[model samples]
Structures are given as C-alpha cells and as structure tokens.
Target chain A: MEFTVQDKGHYTEVAANGRLNMVAAPKLRKVVDEVVNGGGKRIVVNLADTSFMDSSGLGALIGCLKLARQSGGDLRIAAVQPQVTMVLELTSMNRVLTPHATAGEAFGND
Target chain B: MTDILARRTLEEPAAEQAIEDLHVLLEQLWLDAAFVPAPDQMAFTTAVIEAASNVVQHGVPTEGATLLLGVELTVAVERLRAVISEIGAAPLDPVPDLAGPSDLPGPDDDALLEDYDESGRGLSMIRALVTTVTVEREGDTNVWVLSRDSGQG
Candidate 1:
C-alpha cells in the first residue's frame, strides 16, 4: 500500500491506495499514530483509491478513530469505495466512524 | 478425470492471491461436481484462505520463508469434501479468541484495540465461518487441517 499524508495546520489527511490487508495494516497504524503524535488529531482518511480492505484494515481504522477521539479530536473517512464500504458496514464500523462523501465534508469545511 | 487442483509448497507472500485463485478453482470444481448449495465448498474456501493468511503473517520468516499449501477435492454421492493442509512453524499460543459483538471495544476504549493489534483474528474469523479447524504437528513442521460438510448448510 502507498500512503501520502497532507498536513493543513488544523487537520491531517491521509490518502491510501492498494490492498489494506495484514501486510499493510501495521504501516497504516503507524501513520495514524504519527498524525496523532504530531498534534494533528482531526483526521480525514481518503480511501478513494483503495481497491480492497479486510477486517485487519478495519481494525486499524477503528484504532485510529479511538486515538483521535482520545486526543480531543475526531477521525473521519471519505470517498470510500463500495467494497471497502461493505466490510466497514458489515463490521458495524460505518456507524462508529461515519464516512462522508468528500474530504471537505468530513472536515466540515463544505 | 475426477476434479483435482493442487498448489504445493506455496510461499507466504503469494498466499493472498492464491486464495482468490482458489475461489475460482473451487467454483469450477463445483460445476464439474454437478451439485448446488455446497456449503462445504464455501467453508473450505474460507478456512483455507484464513489458514493461508495465518501462515503468511505468522508462520513464515519475516524476511524469506516458504510455506506449503495443498488443496484436494473429492466428490461423493451426497458430499463434496476438500482437504486443506499447510506446513510451517507453529503459530503463537493463545490463538486469537475472537470477541463477539458484545465483546468489541467500546466507543471509549482505545487501549484494548491497541493491545490485540498484532494478533490473528483472521484465523478466528475463519474458524467461525467453517465447521472444523484442527492443528497437528509432524517433526518440526506444523500442519493445519480444516474440513466442512455439506450438512452445515
């Protein structure tokens, strides 16, 4: 998986592409921690380019959400594809993380 | 020829795509077997995928290790049986005990999620989806055997 991070002062956005399975889960966790540790707690993860995801990937996202929340901010997701969304919904994470249609919407800037 | 598909000594990194390929292969086998509603086939597929993922993540060497995955199919009058085997190092103890929905991390807890982060929940998911999950040891190699019956449906 390839991840690119964008920091815009108040919030951070992580754009991820490729499969988010066991091999990539740890890397994603590290990214989430980096964002929180850098004091960029409000996070928007853009999954527009992610093609596949599994339960481990979901777990990582949930962990990130927990971290962001603990730090007095929130983590939101945007532009998730159908397949990834299916896993999230089946696992009932959609209700917890609350995906938005766009990054700007998740950031409440639009 | 009776339907049979075999992939032997499958390396760890190749397991994920191999699982996808096995799905297709099992579908073709179903067609040849002339049976519908083969729950065992689906269970076998899920179990093998989970086993392969486990081997990839835990059993093989982090740098370079080889694991063997073999699948064989047999069709009888009222049953379709698949045998899946993997040879590798024994997985870590306390194999994931998957928590039910009620046991999930609460909306407020972050520590529990982090504590179990590296464990093998995939294997637990597989066990939940299948009828039987077993492990055996032969010399230094560990073998996982998984089976499911059509009656499970």
Candidate 2:
C-alpha cells in the first residue's frame, strides 16, 4: 500500500492507494499520527484507490480518528471504494468516520 | 452433484504476500463464475480475506517451524466456499467465539467504536458475512471453512 500526504490549506489530505489490510494498517496509523503530531489538524483520508480493507485496517482508521480528536482536531474519510465501504458499513464504523464524497469536500464546510 | 463452476488454490508461507496472492486467486475464481452477484462476491471476498489474514497474523508455528498458508476457493452455482489452512501451525487455543454480536454498532455504542478490537472484529465480521463458518484442526493444520449461500441477497 502507498500513502501520500498532501498538506491542504485547511486540512491534510492523505491518499491511500492499495489494499488497506493488516500489512498496511500500521502504516496508516503512522501517517495519520505524523499529520496530527505535526499540527496538521483537520484530516481527510482519501480511500478512492483503496480496494480492500480488513478489520485491522478499520481499527487503524478508528484509532486515527481518536488520535486526531484527542489533539483537538478531527479526522474524516473520503472517496471510499466499494470494498472499503462494505467494511465500514458492516462494522458500523461508518457512523463514526463517515465518508465524505470527496477529499476536496471533506473539510470544506468547516 | 455439487458441481464447482470455478476453483482456485494457493499454498505458501503464511505471510502478508500470501494474503495478496490469495486475493488474486479470488479474482480468478470470480472471472469463471460471473453468475454470482456482486454483493455475494463482495461479502464472501471480505470474509475470505479476513480468515486468511488471521492465519498470517496469529497462526503460531509449531516447534518454531515456518508456518504456511493454504487456500482453496470454489464457486458453485449455489454457494461460495473457501478453505483456509494454517499449515505447520500450533493448535488454536480457546477456539474463536463466532456467536458474538454481529449487529451493526449503534450510535449508542460510540465508545465501543472508538477502541475497536482488531482480532475479535475479524471473527465477528466473518460470521456476519458468510452463511456458515467452521474451524477444525486436521493434523498439523487448522482449517477454516467459510461458506456463503449465494442465493441470498
């Protein structure tokens, strides 16, 4: 899995391209942690290219959301593909980390 | 006769690469059995991946030997099935609890959503996705059989 972090003016957009499974779960946490620790508050994880995600990947996203919130910021997800959407809706984490339509619109209203 | 419309199998070291390869194997199986609906395919694929990932992540090697992952996927007219084998692995202690809650976590369970348990969730997710799942120890292998009735919506 490859993760690219682009510092959007209002938020940091992290594009995760590839399967977001156990192998890539920890990397996601690390990327999001770096963003939060570096003071990049509002975050959007772009999952348009993420084709698959297991429970480990879901756990990492939940953990990232908490880490961002605890730092007085917020973490959101955007551009979820079909497989990723299934995992989120199945696990019901979709309620907590609701997927925005697109990365550009993630923190747009805020 | 339970005719298998399509089948794919893989055996390799129980590692991350095995999971990736197993995914490709699934796609190959689907290509031949396009009669199965997308929803069934999506759910079954997710469950299969979860089971395979469990072996790669948690399967203990007996006597410090290398653990191997073996998978057999079959798509029949009525069902989708996968047998994931944990070869050269130690016995699973306190077998998985599959009868756990499969309900969608409600807004009331916000706290539960925050600190999600990765391992346990995989089992629960598998149970929810597939029609039936069973784990058995066969010699030096722990085999997980996941089956989904493709007839359902």
What TM-score does the predicted chain A of each candidate obtain versus native chain A? 0.93, 0.97
lDDT of 1 by residue, B1-153 (tens): 434333223332335566555545655666665453544554454445556656555664323446655555555544445455454444436544433332333253244344444234455455555555666656545556655555522
Q: Categorize the docking of model 1.
A: incorrect
User: Predicted candidate 1: what Cα RMSD to the true structure?
Assistant: 6.3
CA-based DockQ, model 1? 0.17
lDDT of 1 at A108: 83
- Model 1 clash pairs? none
- The number of the candidate with the highest lDDT is 2
Per-residue error at B140 for model 2, in Å?
A: 1.1
In model 1, the runs with Cα more than 4 Å from the true position are A8-10, B1-9, B12-50, B60-84, B91-120, B127-153
Top-TM-score structure, candidate number: 2
Q: List the residue pairs that clash in candidate 2.
A: none
Off by over 4 Å in 2: B100-109
CA error at residue A49 for candidate 1, angstroms: 1.6
The value of fnat for model 2 is 0.78
Task: Give the top-scoring candidate (DockQ).
Answer: 2
